[model samples]
Target chain A: MSGRHSKHDLETTPDDKLLRKLEAKWEDSPTRVLRWHKGLDVRGLDCNSAPGWDGDKDDGGALVAAHAEELSELQERLFADGRSGGSRSVLLVLQGLDTSGKGGIVRHVVGLVDPQGVQHRAFGVPTAEEASHGYLWRIRNALPRPGYIGVFDRSHYEQVLVVRVEGLEPEETWRAHYDEINAFEAEVAAAGTTIVKVALIVSKDEQKARLTERLERPDKYWKYNPGDLTTRARFGDYLDAYQELFEKTSTDVAPWHVVPADKKWYSRLAVTELLLGALRSLDLGWPPADFDVEEQQRLLAET
Target chain B: MSGRHSKHDLETTPDDKLLRKLEAKWEDSPTRVLRWHKGLDVRGLDCNSAPGWDGDKDDGGALVAAHAEELSELQERLFADGRSGGSRSVLLVLQGLDTSGKGGIVRHVVGLVDPQGVQHRAFGVPTAEEASHGYLWRIRNALPRPGYIGVFDRSHYEQVLVVRVEGLEPEETWRAHYDEINAFEAEVAAAGTTIVKVALIVSKDEQKARLTERLERPDKYWKYNPGDLTTRARFGDYLDAYQELFEKTSTDVAPWHVVPADKKWYSRLAVTELLLGALRSLDLGWPPADFDVEEQQRLLAET
Candidate 1:
């Protein structure tokens, strides 16, 4: 209402100019959001890079708030579209090393929309049952049904990432998973799920600081996994695994986004904006009402 | 402890004689269980017939009890075996006309196992999303994960059965589904899932009687779907649909069993026995312990 457009116009617009404006500002902002393309040389990419948000914690809060209303309304349209024969949905696959503020992204970014609209699955060590199926089997089951946004805290990448670094399976076994995973993602996309995968890149110094803080604070102990240090010690191997992961899996259908996550607010805002872009790309509209609206209006007025 | 042989012996036996003995009694019993084989014509099959249970309600109760303990034990072992790495499971696909006692079989037959070990998905009208994918997409999502007994209240056969009878889609569409379903089941079976399908056959009069009873009782109103009567009106079309369903979709990986379901008690027992036979065929053994037993025992004793 305050700008050239009305509130309704903002809500219904396919690609709202406001969203594009905010995104443009984000492009030049201190905190950097990395978009993965085919044949990305992840080795050259620096984990410490932020879009360059060197401001205080409160920085970018106003921009996130500006887009919040549109984001919320767009999420509803996405849900409604899916329910009404659209049969389409979004899956945000979040993967990163420990203490990369994965939880913050979930809490601050995704938390803006209706909770019921989001399906969250946290992948842990595979159950003997899950392990029995090809690694991607449980993934298929956890996929969001139509009319919902699905978030994977960690995903099938474990087959390549942790499994590779830990030497849990023979190199021959885990190595083949990259292609299988690519094919699987391709199939899932072909079946109508738009996949937006994000890797939260945190610097080693930043990770050390977060882990040390967890140790010092009793409140954060529950979030702490001692295994994180073990994983961190093999950071080079893990980084190489991720490099291969990006190179191999960043397909046209489901591309991976690598965002520097040293700043929690910047990362959260980036993810929120990333999801906004994904949802907007669907060009979702409100579903038509099933019942006779005129008759319902008459009945309600009479009652 | 009271049995003549040890419990371990019975569990370890490839095919227990006692189970076979009970199964043998079932073969000659008045209430007959339908076993479909290659080239068997389903048209000749009698819906009104049941394995004769001349005795009162208590007649087969003892036999059911006899197997209950072992069945329960075997189910736990199946769960444990899967947890250890076997990744095996059984899917009981139940199909039949209205008032065919699919619910009763779910309750009385499948109810014998631990609730945690059973994955029951009662499919209803397909969501727009489900229809967008091939008919089997939702079915795949509903499949039993490893280490569980999965039950389909009604299944993909509806595409060939109800969808066919009602002309919900073109003849070309429903006709192509049978081969697709067969190939799908074959893959599911090859993936370590043992599929057992049963259609509880109740005659027209029996369905009529059940529907009337539901109409007369206020308590049973919830179970009554008026659409069931409409479905009953087109019985011949449905019957022809089934005959085609049996002829096409039944494969080595998953087969259809047409059982006499006029008698709930007898049919329930027959289905229970059918499932038991399927599970026993897997020749499951308890998964070995993960820890060193003697050392753990010594540590506990010392403590």
Candidate 2:
């Protein structure tokens, strides 16, 4: 308990074997794991860290594959248990650099459940309408309803990360987002949502390779936007911003996990494990039969 | 073409065969189908009419089952086509008496697609925050993003139907919703979303029988609310309200379809076909590949 499920990781326990294997296999958090530039030194910490897989992509893939069925079942129970009322839900807040496989996480990882159970959104630039309100306005509206799995591919954290890095707000305004985000997450969690935040830690080299692929591949061209390069040029600034983000935002109630995402398979598996862990921690079970099953079965047969 | 695709039908051609069978088999609009008490006559139509299937539930079931795979594929194409920045989405607005099977449509019909493609919401009573804004404020936010299918279980129509019947607002205010709704639908349609509204026509007798079943069956108790009987008492008034609704709100761009929903299978097939038609009308295809596929394929192989 002291070394592993320490107070920093909060009190989450993996929901199933697959999630357990994943947690055991990875560097728990990037905060301690590669030494993220303690105050502008900008040294140590390899972006390509895939801590638990022994540098073996196949092993990670197989592990995730093994857990797929159970993960899906757990998700179903999580959704069903939420229906009786209360905000019993899970909101997986995914934040990553561009081309960091957010879409893939949505499709391959979360896509395993019934569509009726999800309310997924990918937050991009705020529309003029959305921008009129506080940054958290549209986000509050998108919070998952009771008995749902609300996936935010990118979320309110942007107010601090991207907004802070790009000077979208004055320095004072951007600096205020840390407490704002924490307050927002705490409110959502108090409302019966288990908030699991994951940052896909991809290397700059990997992002460059991905951008090159988009240029080189016709099918991927639609996904390419010129704006990505502007963000890429300011990578160092963003990295510093993220480091500051971890320092200010990681909380006891909603801890942030920076999963090494250079390996798409490894990152996806780790994220899945984290989500399953949150769900399992809830001890979700099917809502009790609303009526007498035996009598209903007899009546159904009569019908 | 004149009789087969009458102007009254509002000019829709199904996107594929299942949809064709569905539309060809049912009365195009329930407004005309139900003998809506047109000022004391009360003898123009019956509440239970399935014009196309010889009133056989099995035929409808077989038809829907036949088109299941194709419908799923078409939905995927519809979703994939919308990923590029445009309003190419479908909003299926369902209005019906309770237990007319809105949840069923979402589960059995819409459930076939990858959940990533859907943004399904069931609108109940507006929360305190929602009531603070104009009714449409939250609605506009809930509209499906491009490349998604948005299914509103109960929609803005409730503003006119339930709110009007119960006098939640003054006569002057509820009366104003007609043009307000028409303007809203027109705006949404003009922006690229094809709106297909369906009113599930269930006879009072059928509703009683269904409600009775809910009481008799244990599994369905969760679905029952005593308040449904109060609404049922106002059935005649509600019918008049709906008649007025159809007259003022149905427009060429976004018309209403009334399907005989006494038979669950028939209504489900009818709706599936309607959605398939809307998707088909978009002529959605994989967003034209933006990069050189051959080169990417070659590079992909090298990697």
Candidate 3:
């Protein structure tokens, strides 16, 4: 947890008040709190550390539960704004290794809002059709519509990360993608979409434990893939690739937030707070009625 | 409320046990509990009544909350089944008049499960491109992938309801759609998708109150459409259209469940019960591990 704030301070600031305070802190930099910046050592970062969050799992779960109503309210406002001729939307990009708690974050955090307002897409190994198109083609197609909160579970960053680590593309081809990704994100941001890119960092030991649990449980077998072990063998390489990804693709329009995800509850809380900051930045208000309320009331009463 | 089952009977059966009892009742006819049969008069049915649910709003709300965990678990099993090479899926089609609490059912009932396992699509007035294609073209594209709970807010029935009432198409063109929709639904069901088609029935007087509430609240203004008034003016004609719709399109494969939607809580509970029945019919258990668990455990240990 950050030293600037204590657990007592968080306990005092609850619900909307806490959200507003965090929004102010976020406005100071947005990246100043939980972001992965240039030259930061990704390997050295503690996966269990809950940066800017001073609480245990039980407290974090309670905090998340408390934020649900407000989160739902804000999402409804966003949906209403879009329906009433507003073009602004939000896009949350989640990037992580297997067992880094990406699915958990989607279930616990994004699940706080109405699913009607959410557009969720999980990118995997490209299909033959997708591989035929330019890398950004499918990504552009999946951008959130106006007034929506879009969540991409394992998104376009796989182009630079997996493609680079696995040598799926030529060196020159994958190397040129960072600048292209940045430009693409800038374009999306300029088109009134707020993009929040997140990297969930989990330690190798934690991932092994999780994988062992998955293997042990029959119900969890569907989630396990043998290929995950291949990826696990190259953990250091993936981290190195992620290090360069942050150095290049993190931008003012869409910065990357590296969430320590060994503690599932903390990661969920951090993502929830980051999403709150993103929605609050929009400063949206309930759209005023477009019709003549008195006339409509009279008409409805007569009917 | 049905006389066959008293409030005491419902109180004794709770959670999965309640779900099982209802599933048995559902298997007896599936429509015996809530079906809108041929001789049933649409206008005469009590909109505020809670059929088969002998409980107050508080009790209904509590029941829905209690079912949440089991609902989530069943959905996960369905998802895992799909991921493990199963072809089964469930489609929940929501059709209703304006302010009939379609959105409320979605927010309160369907919101109980993980959104990732659900695919939600809302069909409205067709765009220029959509109008050019055959009516079912867009609908076919929106069917749930294997292992998903697909929800449609307003569906293909709009072809018969609004199109016929509004005279958007020729008499021959719109009338032919009933058989076409049945054929479409039968084909979808034959492909291993259990279809739960719901018609939320709200009385005209209740609708007037709901629309008036929308008009009164600024936050709800976006939901109010001038065209909704135009539709309400022809409410009788629309009911006649729906009467013919139920008589023609309701089939063994995808029967229509007419939910009394005047009481929002009752409607939510009824829809939740219907969805529970649909998922339970699949009778899915956790997919067994395909790999040697002990070997994988050893491999994970090495990692």
Best candidate (score: lDDT): 3
Write candidate 3's Cα lDDT for B1-303 as tens digits: 021232225465445575454434333433467877778878788998877765577777777776676688889989999988899999999998999988887887888888889899999888898889999989999999999999999999999999999999999999999989999999999998999989998999999988988887776888998888999999999888888898998898998888888888878878888898888789998888777778777777887
Q: What is the lDDT of residue A216 in candidate 3?
A: 70
Error of 2 at A281 (Å): 2.3
The per-prediction i-RMS, to one decimal, reads 15.0, 6.0, 1.1
Top candidate when judged by TM-score against the true structure? 3
Cα lDDT for residue A91, candidate 1: 94
Question: What would the per-residue lDDT of candidate 2 be over residues B4-35, giving only the tens digit for each residue?
Answer: 23222565554345456644554453233432
Candidate 3 pairs with clashing backbones: none
Candidate 3 off by > 4 Å: A1-31, B1-31
True contacts kept of 3: 0.66
Which runs in model 1 stand beyond 4 Å of their true positions?
Answer: A1-303, B1-24, B28-33, B38-44, B52-57
Candidate 2 lDDT score at position A261: 71
TM-score of 1: 0.49
Cα distance off (Å), candidate 1, residue A259: 47
Query: Distance from true position, residue B203, model 2, in Å?
Result: 6.1
Which of candidates 1 and 2 is the stronger one according to DockQ? 2
What DockQ, between 0 and 1, does each candidate earn?
A: 0.01, 0.13, 0.63
Question: What's the lDDT for all of these models?
Answer: 0.72, 0.72, 0.84
